[model samples]
Target: MKTAAIRALPASATVFPILFMISTVHLLNDSMQSTVTALFPVLRESQHLSYGQIGLIAFMMNITASFLQPLVGWFADKKPRPYILPIGVCFTLLGVVMLALAPSFAMILLSVTAIGVGSAVFHPESSRVAYLAAGSNRGLAQSIFQVGGNIGSSLGPVMTALIFIPLGQKGVLLFVIAAVAGIVLQTVVARWYAAVGAAPKPKKAVAHDEKSALKLSAGKVRMSVGILILLVFSKHVYLSSFTSFYSLYLIDDFGVGKQQAQWYLFAFLVASAAGTFIGGPLADRFGRRNIIWLSILGTAPFSIALPYADPFWSAVLCICAGFVLSSAFSIIVVYAQELLPGKIGLVSGLFFGLAFGLGGLGSALLGEIADHTSISTVMHICAYLPLLGIFTLLLPKDAELRGR
Candidate 1:
């Protein structure tokens, strides 16, 4: 029941600026990726991407982020992670610059790959740092951290549109400005971080016996991790696929206009933003096991509910469903980190990585279903994966979920 504060993860003032820098960078990278979704016709027609290829490019960052995030997290535990934040920003900046200047498909893919890899590198370290800065109020702090990403996703379309306005002159200049700002921020932050004797680590509630508890085999942890991966996959499909396409789907299928259809996305994100705060406390009070199981199971009825509703009410269904899907996100990371208290970085990365990287692949497949089948069909099919996560988590919670 004891909840004591950990030593400051960064300089007291530094935490806010670091979070600010990281959040802003996230905004830019996300805004830039909307390039594929918003400019689909232009990019697809000119470059001749297959339906699969287009989705792949859209989620390249997810795939790479999935693959590399755990390794980055693992290393962060052993060595200095201060530099990883701005370094991730640098990757996005470079990648975006390449995208703006891309002359061929190969170059475009390469640039997109950089963006993916870069995002992966930043997540574990950033999440860990965010965890520390949060101190005793993990739930509240993490929700704010998550909201930054939500804000970024929302900005994606808006920023893309703004940049697209002055396509030739302003777009190019805006990108240059983004890259330079990132580089400068990285430089300043790294210098400040270098003065530490020990690297950053979150303050644990109690120093649980590290060696005895770590005896849980990697195999067992991986299985739990695997279940989490399934959970995240479903999550990605619901968010990446549904969130990205519902506006279009509502318009195309329901004979709604783009402006009216956007209302669905707005409502859905609002619900989801609420869900993040809701899920965290539920996990802290009840167990992550029960909450996740119920949340995933809830997806089935909600998914089925959405397509059947009359147009007017369908937006309501999608909004509620989006919230159900999003509710688990931050809760899942907190759960995973608690389980593998042994490998916070690795756990953090894997929590985000599969969600980003492998989940990136899943997102595209969802997109393909959209391209060929129907968006509703894709959503319905994707809903089942969360139900599968129940088995993965059945073994028992790997870590405690005590709130201070």
Candidate 2:
């Protein structure tokens, strides 16, 4: 009977509509999340916030997501919850509403925590959807899913320049529309997910999956996972510097206006989005290990040059850094998924959680450094983070990952 049920499952195929729809929701979800950082300038001026306080705001949001995501993924792995998709966005909606009206720092922290909780729920499950929907084209599907987030995140600078700077904190109210749209779209995606969940999977495929997962020794698997986590730390901490402080760096160092600083940040983020879109197919063509090594390590030259460049050159170097650095994350996620073939939700949640956890921790620590030292010092220090990418050479080769 079990085998019969398993045999009833449909063969995997690239489901573009579901992938695109979930990608769209990712855009909405991340754009809403980006509002937190986008409002930093406004919040700083309006509330006379210290750099530490600013960092704490990001810490509160990201830490909440980080702690919760793995647990959420664990639970979903045991018992799939299709409706959790739209239900999670409801938390974000509530958070956004609270953020717009939040009058104090404590209130803002609470609001962002709610948004974080929403993110914790959203990512693991959505990634599982992408995995399910991906036939042989997992790379393209994950890229499609991730590029939405990169583009959505890119909007932060644009929102800072156009909305947050002008409208102040109240500008966050605009994202309420985005949250609502996410809920509606997630609902549509949920139905498909439920249907797919009820279908059958082939027994031979299940055996193959089990075999692939056991290809590496337990110690080897543990070591590889540890290496992957360190890579995530390197990638995200460096990125947190840009997302949380790059604009401030420009405003302070080069005497650029706030809006102008945001435009510079915007160029970097847009390049990141383009890189995310490009990275996956390249990985599919080349190999995950090669791309991961090149993508993370490749940014070293550009990043090392950024802190010393003139304002124009700073923007150019940042663009280069963002493009090269951004490509690694989706590839990393896909690679990790390959490493642990059957535990999709748990792996997704763990890595995404690590990304958030590391970024938030880095932001908080860097903010302190900036307060005691200078933003330039912070930039100078963070420039060396990419060099840690040299460790990627330790990861198992793509052929080994295929059990070759």
Please count the clashing residue pairs in each candidate, in the order shown: 6, 1
Could you tell me every candidate's TM-score relative to the true structure? 0.79, 0.96
TM-score of 2: 0.96
Query: For model 2, how many clashes?
Result: 1
Question: What is the number of residue pairs that collide in model 1?
Answer: 6
Per-residue C-alpha lDDT of model 1 across residues 1-404, encoded as one tens digit per residue: 11111223533322455445555554555555445454443455567765566677767757777778888988877885676677787787777788778888777778878877777876677677556555454544555667656655654444434444336312643665655666676555454445432344334523553543465667766777677777777777666765456666666678875545555666676677677657766766776777777777676677766766877787777777767767677777877766666566777787888767655676688778777887677656765555654564464553432221
Best by lDDT: 2
Model 1 TM-score, all chains together: 0.79
Residue pairs with colliding backbones in model 1 are 61-116, 62-356, 62-357, 63-357, 66-353, 66-357
- Prediction 1 global C-alpha lDDT: 0.63
